[model samples]
Target: MSDQRSVTRSDLVAYCDAMLESSAFQDYCPNGLQVEGRNQVRRLITGVTASQALVDAAIEQGADMLLVHHGYFWKGEAAPLTGIKKKRLKALLENDISLLAYHLPLDVHAEVGNNVQLARLLGWQIRGGLEPANPRSVGLHGELETAQSGAEVAASLERALGRMPLHIAGNDRPIKRIAWCTGAAQGYIEKAIALGMDAFVTGEISEPTVHSARENRIHFFAAGHHATERYGVQALGERLAAHFGIEHRFVDIDNPV
Candidate 1:
């Protein structure tokens, strides 16, 4: 069913790992080629997470590999394959579908990174990293081409990401400077505040983040984690497909959280 040509699995994995610079960052899970399937891949599927639903979808699509931002084997998770994890792995293995994942490395990529892709979709101008001293800073600070109210910014995010972001207004003034990190990066609000950003945007929120936003007088937006991270893997997949002349499809398994 795939119209695209096939490429060796090793070449595809090597190219992705090198492009993402997976070795540069210490991450919770392995960066690339988490599981091996066929020696050659013709059709590839990309998603935000490798959940059971996503695995099932990939199998249905006849995907040779399932590439994602979040995959199995986290730092503290039990080693045994059981419960939901067991089912997910079983589906992939039985279907002969490879699983490839990248965590912080995918976050820090300048071109196809989640933060950069979000900015591209939302039209934010990138100025620099949240932690400028660290080469692989996960968060970024930037400016809006034109100043807009907190409410207006929220609207833009809702339109672009197709999800209503939880906005916490800290001030009445218009917002020009902003900082953002995708996927459960609410903790980086402090870094944004230290940079004197007018607002901070990230996926997922904690109770303390509200107090910090109110006290620090910076607007906060908790966009859904799955929504924020959806773009990077898609972008990476598209790029790989273009480079290798292989079929690529981004199957979005919606996650409200």
Candidate 2:
């Protein structure tokens, strides 16, 4: 049990913005404080996406703040708050719950980001970035502690992620070096191939990824985007709770994809 305490919304947003350097990345959506509700946050709920189910669950839990990876208002999405969007926004507003979102910043953070967290969970020694030139590259290249076959890698992913990945078998060779970027980064497989990685793992697979993996002789794994990205937000929530002595709960709404 932990002592109960409350943190102001402004302070929480400032801490996250500073820690994640939200302004550094040109993200698809705004980084922090999408919907403001309460000033004092005592109970916080963290999730992968700010979907309707998640919002309802947060409201049920009586959370003062809902912190998530996916938030509203994307670059090309319709500006009008209609249908599902309207309902979601309405729930938060009616309940007076603040919504905080961190997108690319949460993916690239050196310690608490999704990529590094996944690496830590799977026991991969991170070597460098997929795009070595880009300081804010979201993908990472690393090596396994020991060489293992493509099947072995898949099995490890299944064990760690709780979902079997869709494996595109490239070659029969063992996988020692690999690269990974979570959440729809299947396009970066080429970067992995160029980096001489034996295997590449990402959230979603495209039509051409199969051909590319087969032609390039590198194993490819399309792990579930939701499963792979569940860690960073939880890690951030834990950090916040420990730092501020506020109650934190991670509500996981199952999503197969």
Candidate 3:
């Protein structure tokens, strides 16, 4: 069992922050060390969100620290902790389990970022960032090894993510050039359209996205937010575990959206 291995909370946080370059990204939420818990971590738990369910799972697993892609204290949120936030923080504090979270940093990290990991998972090679100007752009454009129909692309996404994706066919052309970003990036379809991608994929599809896709004649796919973001955190957890020689487990909270 890896329980015998342990890592100091400071060391773990430092390693992650350095590896992810957390300070570089302008993010909605604060990255790294969201909640303080135990000083020494032996078992680490990772998940997509630091929800109440995930917190409970970490506690149940006897995790010394919890790492996640989504954490608390988003910009413009209420400064005072109350209700669900209070309850979740209380649980972590009482159990002495530290909470570590990364938002845009994890999403944009080159090696373990969600976009890159998704590409690796789907067997597509990235051609370039969706936004050519921004070196650290969140959305990316690429082509599948072989051209496939829009339905075939949706089927491939469903198979990879274990959830059905909503595919909006704007064109009948086989998908060759594709652009994608994970988690509620439907608005980026405009960029994809501007780039003349055959299709665009993201976690959520907004109302305007449908019309934009149809009008622009570019296909759109809304894969699950949770499903697409799963790989990066898991990859981060596995890396941390290997580096620190600690036991790591990824707890799934079954978010279908």
Candidate 4:
């Protein structure tokens, strides 16, 4: 049960940065406290992305702050805040809703992270990071307790994620060992290949990724990006709310990608 208490915005952000170790990551975007609003956060809303729909939902829910896995101000995007970005920021600013976002930090966290949560969801026993050389690797390698056919794994992913994964059968081997990174980490397929993983699962796939998996003879599953990542922010939000004794609600804005 939640504690049903309130916490100040500063304390909440500070605690999250400490718990998630946001400072440690050289993230593409800012990790914590993206947009500041109310001083005290009584009701917290969490979501996959800080999209306009999420902002509206947070406002409707009377959220003091909106916490999400994906936030604005990415590395290569246009810096100027105009068009949809401007509108979204305007809504949050007008409603006095704080925005907190976590990226790589949330994905690699020990607990309540996207990768860990996905493992739990799929009942995969984690072995270690996909890239053992990198201590802070975002993707993880693991095993399915029992080796199963590629189709079986695809079915499991579809059942859990509510989206049919695009399965690319690279080898004729029954899959036991696998690696997965949630949300647009197709580039890490090479890491999975290097680790000799039987299969690789991730959100979003590129044309090159298909060729890589086929040539490398490793099964690849392209699960929906939004679907694979829905859990981390919710888990983090619930824990944060419980720790601070505050009300927390997760608003999922449906996105096919």
Error of 4 at 60 (Å): 0.7
User: How much lDDT does each candidate structure score?
Assistant: 0.93, 0.96, 0.93, 0.94
Residue 97, candidate 2: alpha-carbon lDDT:
99
Q: Candidate 3 residues 1-257, lDDT tens each?
A: 64397889999999999998888888899899989998998999999999999999999999999999999999999988899999999999999999999998888788899999999999988999989999889999999999999999999998999998999999899999999999989999999999989999999988999999998999999998999999999999999989888999999999989
My TM-score estimates for the predictions, one after another, are 0.98, 0.98, 0.98, 0.97
Lowest summed lDDT window (length 10), candidate 4: 1-10
lDDT of 1 at 123: 93
Once fitted onto the true fold, the runs of candidate 4 whose alpha carbons sit more than 4 angstroms away are: 1-4
lDDT tens digits, residues 52-90, model 4?
Answer: 999999999999999999999999999898999999999
Clash list (residue pairs), candidate 4? 5-245
lDDT per residue, candidate 1, 1-257, as tens digits? 54658999999999998999998888988889898898889999999999888899899988999999999899998998888988888888888899999999889899999989999999999999999899889999899999999999999999988999999999888999999999999999999999999999999999999999999999999989999999999999999999999999998888998
Off by over 4 Å in 3: 1-3
At residue 157, candidate 1 shows an lDDT of 92
lDDT of 3 at 117: 98
> How far is 208's C-alpha from truth in model 1 (Å)?
0.3
For the record, the alpha-carbon RMSD of candidate 3 to the native fold, in angstroms, is 1.1
**lDDT for residue 238 in candidate 1, whole number 0-100:** 96
